[model samples]
Target: MFLASSAKPIDESLQNLVVEIETQNPDLLVVAARQLRYSLQQTNIELTITEPRPFNVLEEFIIRAGIEFEPAPTPQELASLLGLDPVFVQSTIKNLQKLQTLAPKSPITVTEQGRLFYDKGAVPQPPYAVQIYAIADSLGETVNFQAEPLNEVVINLPSLTSILQLNESNNLISTFNLEQVQKNLQASGLGLHVPETGKIVTAFRSIGSTQTIWRKISLFLIFDSTTEKLTIHLRRGKQMLDSRSKWLDLLLSEGKISLDTLCKLPNESLNFEREAAKKYQNAETAARLEKIHQQALGNSQKKEVIQLRDREINQKFLEIINTAKQQIIIYATWLNHLNINPEFIAALEALAKRGVSIIISYGLEWEPENLLEIKEKLQAIKTPEDLPSVQLLGLEEDVYLQEIIIDREIYQCGFYHWRNSHESHIPLGELVYQVKKSQIIQEAYEILSTRCQNYAQKLWQQAVEKCDIQLARECLCIWGTLGKLETSLNQIQKNNWLELLPIYLNVVIHNLKSHNLADDSPILQSSLLLLSQVEAEAAFIEQLRLAYCQLLSAIAQQNPDTALNLLNNEVWAQFLRLHIAAETDSPTEFISQQTSQPKTKRKAAAPSTRNKKTKA
Candidate 1:
């Protein structure tokens, strides 16, 4: 792991803190760990960040574990903790916190899982590696065991005893994807489970390649439930001709062994013995990784192409765009904070200096919004020739490339935006790959870009064809269809149109009130004419004025105190007074006559009940 962002001497104060932590009390460690100056800065990792800042994790662990005990014991305080490197111990404990395996508290506690592993043993005791050895032929040669990737064991026994030993391992635990030794099994599929341990022991052999007929090897893997581990033994048949080799010779020479069986056998096989089986792995495993070993040929090598993620892609785009010597074509629906990033601007400026043409087609309705940026950039150029021509390609529809492509060569695609870099979190990326200079790739490039350009030209043509008359006619038809123009405040409020878009409705009302509803344009004429029609409808006008009087009466009858305050308004008093009746034969008097009539509404309730409820 690369440590520190740059090569520099460690700060002496931070170094002192590290020294103090080695033999310091909890209080001193907590104080040292919280120093922001040297906390994460203590160690800046460059790659494979297994744990977030080891320095920070160490400090956090100390604080969390030592908080209850103001001055906890040093690493030396615990028994059996002798002769250990203080720094490595701290680092190891910090790294061991996967799924609560270890908790860093005063008297650091090992969780149940950690205890189980320690109980069995560590390193060699837990069986990180296994070995095996066995015979192969009947040429009366000494048995030898050798496998390329797997270790060899020492077992020199006769065919009868060796076969019996192999049969004893009947555990058929499970299979790895396409990695099973072989499909061969006893007819009954019985005798596969070990009787004493009740564990599955799978035994299989690897048939050598046709080039080496006597290289077949045998192997077995046993799983123990309680320990939760895997121990495998691979044994190669001795190279010398012997009884085992003769048995294999009989199987292959007689044309009894299938070519597929021989061909599928790995040339470099692993031979493990029964002795090294630690049996940590249980019978059931939640996750089994499928092992696929492949050797690629031709141009499909991984090193030829690399994927960029997050900040890497952002930095790469800056690098790629600066290299444009001929032309730059950018298609995007949004512009991120590209202009604000000085590196991006500088690189773009350098590219422009090389007389490279930059064509950007932003596929959004508000296309002109970004045109200001181009104009601003051009203004910055001292010489007209040095200024890159920024042409905005008008697109008919949203036919835009997902990636911000440059010169149809290099491209960066992801959710990241040069625009949103100011935000706290950056949107992650999917992939960024350049096209190869092959016929298939170039053809694909031309087809996709041309399709986008063709659709863009069609859209621009439609926009240019839209004459003033056509636009005005469209506005007239649309307004006439909607007919949602307000005649008064009541209609506006009742429809809740104000909350939906109070600004537009308020503008229309304000224009009418100020006599600014001019008809110089078709849109204004359509709106003004709508209001004229509303005013001409006299029945609607009366209902509009009477609405206030009815509202006042309802409020007054329901809540007299609220109505009293509302009556204070001169206009409201006028409307309310108009509702009062004084014996007369006029139409207004007949309408007001109802004010003197008796009301006849009653609540349905039981007379005997003090408190009663009724259903609607």
Candidate 2:
């Protein structure tokens, strides 16, 4: 929705949100919008909470024993008879006397209160003083009634008359009832100190209350990177409220706030973080290459092995599946007992949407009925193209091996049933060995399941052909030398050149920054040469390449006007801007260097935890 200024701005309420945005991501810029001030009637409530206080087993037993016997037994006699310590018995007697359940004299005799407590099954309802603050909105609705504290709901905003206010309902204050207060107190989790099943408000009376209090709601501008769109979000207490909030719905219905609006607004940039600045500064090309080469050698040489059991298997296995960016190969026996729950299905669906190749291979044939069901469920989530494949290897011999290979690197193998494991019950402890992928293991796996080997090889080939670097050595060799890059580009499709451009550009920029090389460095020159060649071939690629190249050049030469002009004109250049911003010391370092003018500050409201806001 379009933003407008509110008369009484709650600038102080937004400071904490500013600090959070600055800390988490400086990319987001906060702007002010008009706020909705609603009235809340604060009533000082006094109520008696009846809680069931049950007597301990020993206390009950002692009272029962005294009542059953003709003459009550003395502490010494009872202790001796029950084989209990005399001192312990004496202490219990003292406690019983304090409760007025037994006589305070020499003989341990049950009193009238004791007989009544025993008759009522040893559960006594104790009354408690409930001095609580309850809040109610102008809509005849009680606020913070659902397991939330009152201190967090009510905002102390002075001078409510200066801001625009919503009309208070005439019956809002008169609608207070004992039943409502009781339900609220129960839901609010008050009187937790009482050891009882119920925190029922037995009695409620009004001590005092305010006429009407106002709370200022704030607006937030959220940027969705995927969609490349900005949207407005409203704040409720410490949370950026969802669309389902009653307040938001009410405002939308009244036309106080629009559901959709696009407005370009002025905003301020946050200072760059010092810790992040140190990460990308003064990197040398040779040193970076050497490090990459070493890491490659180490990964191939060493295999980290971990043994997982019970819930650890679930955690580690899910982690591998969830973090998979390229491919996932699961080799198991069958899907007869596989749960195929919503969560597992959802994860697979998300991975499929991300274009991850999934290959599920079963050694033995799956039961026909179960196979058909699993196939139908999986087939429903498939994209137009045959993305994920589930198959059974026609094997006569019984196989016991199972493994999950993520990105053809991390390998987890054992007898643990990855799919058949129940979610409700923690799976039985089993030895599952997790190790880094190796050639020997890969060959052995392929031999056991040859049906999927060709498909896996084809996928790997396709990935490499797209210039998607899977190994550190490949990144170093291809980007390190211009000749190697030219040779690789010959194999990649012309249509995929746009995708390849970014990979090449990133490598070039990374080398430039790490080596702290000049603009004319061989890596930079080679990248520019490739860009020129691609631009000469494809007109569309040329346009994108030019925008990015110009942005890069502007950043290097400290030309803020040129960079800003490109950013304003080209939406595609946003990524390039973000890349340069991340690499530089300050996110706005380029703009600040060329243009000395500061942006106009805009007052806006956003959400933040009260605790965090206070600290900020």
Against the reference, the lDDT scores of all candidates come to 0.34, 0.49
Q: In candidate 2, what are the lDDT values of residues 132-200, reduced to their tens digit?
A: 666675533554332232343465543222232445644343565666655565566655323234334
lDDT of 1 by residue, 1-616 (tens): 1112122122333444434432332111111111110000011111110111123434344333332333544544422334556776565565554424355563556554343333333201111222221222222222222232222334332232233223322212222111222111112233232222222222333233111112233322222222212222223421322344344445545666432233222222211211122121111111110000011123356432345666676666677777765555665554432333456556656654554545454445553355677546643632122212343443433322334445556544333344244534353554444433344334434533553444433342343355332322222211211222332333323333222122233233223222233212233223222222232224343333333333323333444444344333343333323322121233233223323321322111112332333321
User: What TM-score quantifies how close candidate 1 is to the native fold?
Assistant: 0.24
Q: CA shift at 66, candidate 2, in angstroms?
A: 24
- Which candidate leads the pack in TM-score? 2
Clash numbers, per candidate: 32, 7
Give each model a TM-score. Answer: 0.24, 0.30
